[model samples]
Target: MMCFCASAKNNDIIDVTRIQHYDTILKKLLYFIDYSKKYTIDDINDTLFSYTANTSPFNQKKLDANYFIKLTLANTGQQDSFLLYTGKAQRYKMYMCDSTGKKILLKNQVTKFSPGLFTNIPYAQIALKKGEQKVFYIALEINFYNWYLFDPVILRTADHAYFSFLHLLQPSRIYMAITIFFMGIMFCMFAYTFALFIRNPLWEYLHYSVAIFIFMVYFGLRLLNIFHFGSLYFLFYDLRYQGLQLLGHMLILLFILSFLKTKEKMPAFHKQVKALIYLQLIFLVVNLPLTYTNTYNYAANIAFDIMRVLGLLYSIYVSIYLIAKNKKKEARYLGAGSLLSIFMACLALYVDRWGNFDELLLRYSGISVLIFMAGVMSQMTLFLLALSYRLRMQEANRIRAVEQLQLENDRKELEKYKAIIDARDSERTRISQEIHDDIGSGLTSIRLLSEIAKVKNSESDKKELEKISATSNVLMDKMNEIIWTLNSRNDTLLNLITYLRHQIVEFFEPSNIILEINLPENVHDAPLSGNVRRNIILSVKEALHNIVKHSQASLVSVNFSFDKVFIISIKDNGVGFLHDKITDHTNGLRNMKERLTSIGGSCSISSNGGTNIELIIPLNTYPV
Candidate 1:
């Protein structure tokens, strides 16, 4: 019995027998192996007889070189046909010979596997007669990507050889179906995450989508046939088959780093993690270009094994560290999901070797790889669950930020409304003060004149009437001034200057004092707040009035300048008055000081070179 057959058949007998057990049928045949790279049909026939190594019904382990497997079929059975079943390999050949060492032609058969689909198994047909034994040798050039362990050769009646071939195809067909299903699911996930990227435009979503896409390609590459493909195809095939795991590790690291905000939250650890990612990238870059080279192609199998384990360990460590540091959201999603992914991936890693535990796993076609696909499905499902939850949290935070911004806008709008109302009330108060100080005094003078005129004759009556006319006209002028200040159209500094120029020209036209006004060159149309305008107008008017009434000055000068502040200096060539006496006049210098203070301004009175009243008001700012 050969390694591929079961052992219930006779050990040391040659008889025409029909065996039912497929494993026992071929496994009981004798077999030997060789490692000669230059072995041909003649070499296999001549040298195969001297070899003495035995393998079971399946060769589940990988060999580093070309191998020649010789099986002596002792068909002591009524079965007239021997059907050999094996997975597709990069290169293979089979020859048959008898005890006389004469080569006999056997039908060369191989299932034409689809390019990217895992759909078929290859078989070899060897015809036999009852109680006739023949020796067959299969020369295999092992390519890890397309190799699958073979079961014991099927021993069937000559009429049922076609059914035996169909039986051999059943396992791979199921494997192809399950793999396509898994691929479909992974592609769906990729599409879903791509949709997420379109919605958010976040880096995390984009990175995660790319990582999932890589996984889809990785799974596809694992199932595709690598034989007879072009060199470039084999180059990529070798990279994906051997080093794609390295790339996956790097992508996984990057996805975690970006998803967790590790750079902002854990700078030092993030640097270490970043270094690991770069190292894995270096391995990928180095290996990708060397995939076709003999040294790298041969050595990649071992190198990526260490690379995968180390990369996964580092990733898990980073996740655990993040969990410890109380990054609750990231920990909640990444910690548990990453562990599940790692557990499942690790489980998948050993699934192909499950034959050690249950030989039936290897005896069947798709059981081991199907379990691997299930493991992949579990991993991706858990990962997607975690990612979806994280995205929900991100969406919530975005909505919260929008709400906070809206609340801030509402607050500012409320403040603006309040400021407008306060301006209205302050203007009303200013109008009231103008009426009382200017119009009311004018009315009082008219009333006094009327009273004095009642006690006098027609000549005194004429003088009183003239005085009443003057006071009445002055009151009317004061009313017009109040109107001018209250009008919203006169809110600019230029308007204030034009109005002040008119008032100063009119007030001094009849006086002996010469008024010299100096203004800034750049005619600013900048807005003046009601409060600033009101306080400035009132203060300037008071200072000018003081100069006209009591300064006894011959000349007065007013200069307006702006730097960090708006400044108005009114100086007169008059004798100085005591500061104490000035304070006694509440609506005079004291009122000027009070008004300036109200608008974040100040006033200073100096009696040198005339009474110099310098008023400084801050130029207010408005939001953009």
Candidate 2:
């Protein structure tokens, strides 16, 4: 009975045959020993049979026999051909052990491996004589890539235990693990950026999409064995990979184009870029069936590779164009990142092709993806920051301009008001001068005439003297009233209204028109400018005079209130004339309007059942 077993390394071994002979033992081993350091193979020779040593350096202590070793023998002088098998291309050697255990090599055969078939290699093998024990060690020579293939070797015991264990712990397995870890991190980063972009759909959203797709594709391919979903097994190998690749390329291109404003510089180039991206998509769709059919896979692969290269070129072109045309910092960042990713991808693939650093290349595929994502993220951040900065600046400038315009308008309006006030003051001075000159001369002459008549002492002369004196006194009072109206200082709406009410009451005491006052009783005495107060008082006096003069009705009402508008309305139930005829060309009505306007107040007069003149003003603004 034979036993079958497995180890922690997951090596499968079946102990069925005690003695086994293999015409050739071929093994393709990949090891993690530093490629920079070389391990030695010992070619031992025994005294019972002399053997030749291989020309390479001999350091048996460095040789890991369990990691790689095989035994094979054939007639040394006759059959120089043996069947060889290896997964990939590598270098190998043959060594013979003599009776004294001094191993020697018959030949060193280094050859390239063609995948999937057995081929013949011409190399001399050792021949064993009767009653003599012959030993031979055929092993792979480690190179810079740490990959090697073995020739056919005969073993007394055929066991797959060691090989399977080494395979389980291969560098590829570590690479796969590392790839998964970084890919997870990349996926997280992409998701984070995507979420931010969704919150704010800035231009960097394009990069987020491309980065997510790249990581998803890579992660999906890596976790293939876990899902074990058939038909989707070779998703990366199918047209979906190419489709995603093209999509990523198009997104990057669009981002660059939009970022640099490239269309402004070269409109024709933009069209070409669009067409090329579209063609790339079309080809990806066209090649799907070809990729699925085994007979056409090679052709599809070639086409896909070509498309990838072209896409790379297109990206490079856009980047270079942006750098050359715009020369902006954002464009530079985008270009630099794009070029770096493309270069890394190509360099990794090239190293794999050169049969060097296979493990490093696989490991760096994930790293390259990470670098690419980081670059894209950096570019996105820069763009978003720039856009935000620009928008903020624009908003600030717009606000500043609006404020400046408002200030200028206010300044111009102030100047206009000043000019109007200056002109009005000049006119007032002229009118005051006329009142003082003409009226004072008339009164003086009348006073002199009255004195002469009084001196005459006749009855008629006395009456004449008294009449002249009364006329002079009336003129004097009129001058005083004019002076008071001109004395704008200390004038206020409240003071003016109080003075007008007093004058009306006194004037009407001897007449039939009974006047009343109703005003804002609780208003604080906030100061009002002289011109505003004078205008309001004069307007109110004129309205009252017109009511007493024109309206025949006896009952009259004067009301004042503070509401949404500060209002003063004077109404009289009299035989009111047509308001339109009065307002049409009436100097009094026009003067009233001018006075109200000077103080930013408005006045309206209407006579329906009664004559009503209402003046409305805004408090703290219109004159007060």
Instruction: List model 1 lDDT by residue over 219-335, tens digit each.
Output: 776556322332234435656655656665566667777877779987887799889878877877776565454435446655665676786687678657756766566456566
Model 1, residue 51: displacement in angstroms?
Answer: 10
TM-score of candidate 2 against the unseen true structure: 0.41
lDDT of 1 at 101: 79
Superposed model 2: Cα runs more than 4 Å off: 1-233, 258-265, 295-299, 327-364, 385-390, 393-624
TM for candidate 1 is 0.53
RMSD of each: 18.3, 17.8
Clashes of each: 16, 20
lDDT for each residue of candidate 2 in 315-402, tens digit (9 for 90 to 100): 7886676567665666566666667666755654444323343345343234443444444444444445544555577689999999
